[model samples]
Target: MPEGWDGTTRDPDEVLYEISMKEDQMLYEEFVQRLEFNKKKVAGEVKCHKYSRRRPDDGWNYMVEKLGAQAKHGVGGGWKFISLPDGSSRPLNDMEKMR
Candidate 1:
């Protein structure tokens, strides 16, 4: 009885069902897109961490060597690694000194 409904038109229930199905399909597609985006974002973060220059490892031996060479010629601050009570060590930067 609606404006576009004619006497020969399909059942109203069937039309409503079809519209609901299309809406569900669209929502599913959007969910998939968002999932893929999150996957790519996580992958990019992993890649950046893997290639970052300041990543800590092996008791900061690499950092010590690199900073040592720079300090040997009096070029920068005497940055050193400090071991915490929790058994983890990190480089003592200027910001830490302020704290």
Candidate 2:
């Protein structure tokens, strides 16, 4: 029997199993931290597009439909539909992709 074990019969395999489980938990936690770090780094590198409505009556449904149309046509990169001061819509230049 080891220092913590009782003087009675004790299974060595059970002790080893507990130690392995603890190690596995530690490894999983480290992996999650790394994954979160990587996710934040990638998000910072990526650019998100902004959408603005032409009129006050044009609501969330209209914006969603336009976005769905763009996605259906396989438009990639961060291209945004911006409403100009004169009530005109245009795709904004994606600075990240341009560079």
Candidate 3:
């Protein structure tokens, strides 16, 4: 990271401020969608499973986030399933994969 790396100012503090603002903006947008996605999950229309073929365990993330797969994204949470590289199959809470 560089001082004023945001490419607008020379003040280092300003750079941090700019970053915070940008993150806040994105967070607001995501928060709105969280409500929307949660509704679908509650409606029994989605399931929480790992969706990323590259990163199965998905780390610590909000449930109403890009979900285990396409239509299932942003609506599944709390479920413990890892997306497998096979593209169609997955193992449920396979802790070994977390490695």
Candidate 4:
């Protein structure tokens, strides 16, 4: 129950805009629930993007394209995990006795 939950006769567009903003601020789990709730509440009118781990960066790329924004970079400028670590690093997926 936030400040603006009085259920007044405000503009529907304004309400939808606020709801969209709040949905964007929600966490991953909460976002999923909110999307489901909104989809049912709005009768499939509200649009959203659902991403899965299998397609990690596709949604990000789509957002960047839609919003006309530059891609984000990590501290090491998009380097892989092994590249971030110093010294001789072995693939965590590759497990074998170092002869």
Candidate 5:
């Protein structure tokens, strides 16, 4: 048997205390983080930022290097998304360069 591995030999109350303490610590940390973020927001330090979600395989370099996408290429390139001039984006297949 492993060291101190006696079956049912440990103190049950102590185990319960340890588990509760760990959970409480986790909840307290999360609350503190939220409180800090709120404080920053109220101080006008938290600014809204546009964020885009992309898959691990979705990126400019990945498109260029892995998928053989031509840089500065027209539509129909292998990139997953096409960035618009208005700070928005769409799937590359949805756009076509006009003649």
Candidate 6:
């Protein structure tokens, strides 16, 4: 139904790249909004902030330090860990194994 998909065949890589770009854009916008919220909280305009990461690699060490302090003061939310099943994960690079 979309005009872009009407009369052309797109390579899979091209479609994946577009999707990744869109995701990144959305995340960046959300990060900016969260930053503003944190600023307000720091200025005593808000009660608290739900601390979350902006990106996947924004210094885990710093995050750990912040969480540690928050927990010590009993002023932060908890964490959740999603576990993967053992022996159920398969290697992605094995093309022959896929068939």
Please name the candidate that would achieve the greatest lDDT relative to the true structure: 1
Question: Regarding lDDT, does 3 or 6 come out ahead?
Answer: 3
Q: Candidate 5, 43: how far from true, in Å?
A: 11
lDDT of each: 0.64, 0.59, 0.57, 0.49, 0.61, 0.56
- Put down candidate 5 lDDT per residue, 33-86, tens digits, no spaces: 889888884455777665766544443422221145454444445445556554
TM-score of each: 0.36, 0.35, 0.31, 0.20, 0.39, 0.37
Q: State how far residue 4 of model 3 sits from its true place (Å).
A: 16
Instruction: Tell me model 5's lDDT, rounded to 2 decimals.
Output: 0.61
Estimate, for each residue in 2-53, the C-alpha lDDT of model 1 and write its tens digit.
7876668688999999999999999999998778777885345424455557
lDDT of 4 by residue, 1-99 (tens): 579688767899999999988877776668778878776863565554575356444222211111214434433223232221224333323332121
- RMSD (CA, Å), candidate 1 to true, equals 12.0
Q: Write down the RMSD of all candidates, one decimal each.
A: 12.0, 12.7, 21.9, 20.1, 12.9, 24.7
lDDT at 27, model 6: 100
Q: Write the per-residue lDDT of candidate 2 for residues 1-99, one digit (tens) a residue.
A: 578866786599999999999999999999987787678753564344556446555433211114444364325523346555556665645752243
Model 5 misplacement above 4 A: 4-8, 41-44, 49-99
Reference-based lDDT, residue 50, model 4: 73
Candidate 6 yields a Cα-based lDDT of 0.56
Best by TM-score: 5
The better-scoring model by TM-score among 2 and 5 is 5
